[model samples]
Target: MSHFIHQHRFPVLLFAIVVVVLAMTYIQPSGKAEAFHTKDELDYFALRSNMDLPIGGNGLFKASGECAGCHGFDEIGFASVDANGNDVNVVDDWRATMMANSARDPFWRAKVSHEIMVNPMHKAAIEDKCTSCHAPQGHYASKFMGESHYSISDMLLDPVAMDGVGCAACHQQSQDSIGLLFSGKLKYTTDVLYGPYDAPPPIFGSPMMAWVGFDAQYGPHVETGDFCAGCHTLVTETIDLNGVLTGNHFVEQATYHEWVNSIYVDDQSCQSCHLPRIEDDVVLSTGYSFLEGRSPYGLHYMVGGNTFILKLLKDNISELMLTANETHFDTVIARTRDLLQNHTLDMELTAEGIEADTARYRVRLFNKAGHKFPSGYPARLAFIEFVVTDAVGDTLFASGLLDEDYNIIDRDEDYEPHYDVINHPSKVQIYEMVMGDVNGDPTTVLLRAAFPIKDNRLTPVGFSTSHFAYDTTLIAGLALTDENFNHIDGVEGSGTDDVHYHIPLNGYDGPLNVSAKVYYQAVPRKWLDEMFDFESDEIDLFRDMFEGADHTPELINEASIVDFVTSVRQPRPTERLKAFPSPTSDGFITIEVPESDRMQVTMFDVSGRMLFNESMIVNRRFPFVVPDKAGVYLIRIESQRAVYTTRVVRQ
Candidate 1:
């Protein structure tokens, strides 16, 4: 016996060490990180554990009906009252949001049909990608299990799939399950329900809890933008018009990453802006625990800048009537309008009377959003509408005007590459993302987009020009010429855009009222009707959505001023030597001479180091590669035509 014990000493010691480690892990005191850490919580060993959950099974999530019985105010047998004498419940507010009825959104349905009809081979990928967010609950449960139907009609036919993003869909997003920030790699489970706050007190005789059998757990992912990115930031395969693969993965949306790269990520979160917390003390339901306590229950309205869609849904009672209650539609609209009007952009207007019977008005638009203005879906567009009129309200010059049918009237008729310099009444400064096909021409078909022909959307604060190489390469000519297209020239790192409008006074000398408004449109009329076919059911259905609907652009932010022009200011001559690609890569620069045939080009480093001092005849565009490392450089051009000084950055 003594000999046996001595031989087994090492084995016994190993067992004791294993036991100690297990005990330490289980008995560790809960800290703030464990209680509310928003980043990924999965360790190396548990990283792939989420895949083991029943994401492909319908039984993995309790229907919203089951949870709403206790969490909702309008559910039968539930009696939760708020401070304002109204029935208060999570479902009551959330159900009416865009998140609740995402699948039922007419635009989504019509778009899915149109895409599939356009490219039959892309049917499965498009359906899977869209359903991953629209009807996440049903899509995950069925698509992952090979039980999904690619057809939009079939998916809409399923009641379980029509619920869109329900309570179970978000609560089941465990830190261990969510893989990556986007592409809908979210995993779900019914056994555990996760939330931002801790300690969801259980009701004494709550049958709903007993039926769900969910262990309430605190998970910070519920409040983090990474979780939202699981659905928001999207990428899809690009296909061309000839049904050929474009070999480029088009960035469909980058709202989440755009916000992540901005300065707002450090201080504010997606939930902070969208789902604002409301302090309240109310009975959650009958037989509730902790009946009266100050709890920061976030408002679940989930209001966004989609005023047109929300109004359309509200007016159409037959479409998802129960999801977004008609009674709460007005409140949601008001909230959405307020968010767009006051929160998105800050505008400042300054004007001076110019010579040649013209008024020069400078409009600066500062992007206040965490991401680019009109960040989501590429279809969204936002532009400045600058108008000047006389005291008698007689229109003098107006840009960015839309016809009665809501079609942009001031845009180039031939759809010339893009517009940066809008000097004439027929020209307008439009801020939008225009996708291009493999041929480098603008195309509206999302799947056929190989690159962005034009993306002049105002960049967020702290925009890194390096991140937009594709845009710089393709649209650099116009981008470099227009300050509004590239704010980096004047306010690098600061997401503010300035536009100087030179409107011809045309002999009008009286005080002119200068007005500027920023209008946001979800879908441009040209894009919507470009590929539209009245004979096709899908196209007809899409067109029907706008019938009798308020499809007009929503005014995001506006500024008006009375420019008392008593005198005229002379117009400055245009800069002679033009520079293409101001932010030079590989230390290369191009200088074009439109008027003079001879000029002197001088270059200086940031430390005032003289790099290049040479005289050359520039009859045409001159290209030079400076032999300097990556840094800021100053270039001066002196010619018989004009003298110009410009700052250039080398990378």
Candidate 2:
């Protein structure tokens, strides 16, 4: 019997395997039975199911609507209202901001689609990386559950993703390597929601956990600039035009690094200006009547200098599925306008009396923000519109004038260079960062960008070229050579720029009226040209929106001197002291002190380090051998009447 069984065992096993396979095919779950089924396919189904769940039902991220229940405006006045009864609700303020509508930003969507069209092979990588910040909740949630490549399709379908930078996205952020880790490298805790306030007593916290499935915990990092750095400091890989990796990276936006290099780093966080603290103690949660009114309440208006996109979002609210309405958007836009006009910059326009039939005026700009003025996206720019008119309102000279389509009329063929002096109407001073491709030509494609061709954006106070973060927030092109761009007496960190406008009087100098204005454009015409050239659904949609919308740039600041006449002034000996071969290639600079009785001259480097000091009576030109270093130097001359300082550049 044993010998018979051994011989028949092979046949029995084969028959059993066939029976089991047939049974499994007929009775098993249809998903498991499919031959081509992959883990991603299964996970996608699960992801869809989780996303479809009502609000807080999802195990990880909850829809922002869930938070709106407590944080939104309340008619009963129990929460979110200031002492003056102004409704400063968190959800209402945030909903209208670019941060809230980041996912719905038509320009960003169009740009992303444009990049994908240019580099089809990198579609997956681009979508995944972009959604990491824009649609973080959905992207991170899917990634958390082992799903790879969160695409735009996934973002559109997921309710959490469409919420943009929602409550959970920021509150659930884990305080781990925040400032150090950038470019959407964010970490999150599953069920812990962070806030600037300390953890509520168990009585309040328990309800929060019960209501939203998240424990409200104290997280000081939530109030830090480093927390925002996770997204603000973006460094992207450089790719060739043919979709090949260039083995280099570009600092796409360095808002965080720019702040770190400025004077405000020690005193202010990103929240200080954007969020705006309210001194009145105010209730944080609705229905918690016994809860003490919290002090230092920050309004959740996370606005930047992107009023153009905000207006676009407002106009197309229904199309974008925005939670905020038209009125909310208008309120936010007004706030943004105020921020750009009052907080961003300060300008002083002075008439440097007419000289040689050429009326000279100096426009000095001081950046007051924590970072560079017009920082963040490289496309943003602020240009000075200087105009001089005759007594009867005839145009004498005008630079930085825009065409009907909002494109700079006098913009250079490639890009405008930073100018210390503008003698002609064609030369305009535009504060912006221009990206260049491998060929050193300007390119709007982020992936193709190899380096910055021109980045003369106004730096913040205390911004130094020698700072550790200066490499990322560099002053490129002609601005690097302009001594007055961010320097005073060759000392860096002035956060100011002086543009001397030498407008020709043209024999008509009767009461010249001068007006100097600084205008900012987030979605500049030049930036739109490249993106519009691409044929895609996103691009088409954005083009339609842009064409229909008003293309007026926001007036950041303006100054005017009405009815001014050139007058002769008494000249001093110090004013006559001339420094020849200003940007000297040789080691020596000739100082011609015309009427010098006894004068002390001192020389300093860009860092304010003194190099030489000499006191001598010189009536004629003398060659003073300067340090042979190739950089900006400050030369100070002291006489009896005045002390004068001028910059000398060594080539």
Q: lDDT tens string, model 1, 1-651? A: 000001224435965996686556654355322322224543422331211111112445555655654565532333455557565567656665778768788777777777777888878777877788888776766644566443455455455566778888888887864526566667766477776665545423335355566776678778777778787777778888887786778777777777776767777888887888767665554545545443676667677788887888887756433454465666778888898888898876655346567677777778888788877777788877888889899888888888888877767752433454446777777777778788887776788877776776777787666654223222322554665554534655567767778878777766677788999988777777555753366567657767768887999877776654542232334364566676777777787666555455667678544466455666666777765588877776655445567777777
**Candidate 2 lDDT (Cα, 0 to 1):** 0.81
Which one wins on lDDT? Answer: 2
* Residue range 103-148, candidate 2, lDDT tens digits: 8888889999999999999999999999999989878888787777
What is the C-alpha local distance difference test score of candidate 1?
Answer: 0.67
**Top TM-score: which candidate number?**
2
Summing lDDT over every window of 10 consecutive residues in candidate 1, give the lowest-scoring window: 48-57
Clashing pairs in 2: none
TM-score of candidate 2 relative to the true fold: 0.79
Q: Return the lDDT, model 2, position 600.
A: 58
* TM-score of every candidate relative to the true structure: 0.73, 0.79
Q: After superposition, how far is residue 169 of candidate 1 from its true place, in Å?
A: 1.7
Provide the overall lDDT of each model, using Cα atoms, as 2-decimal numbers: 0.67, 0.81
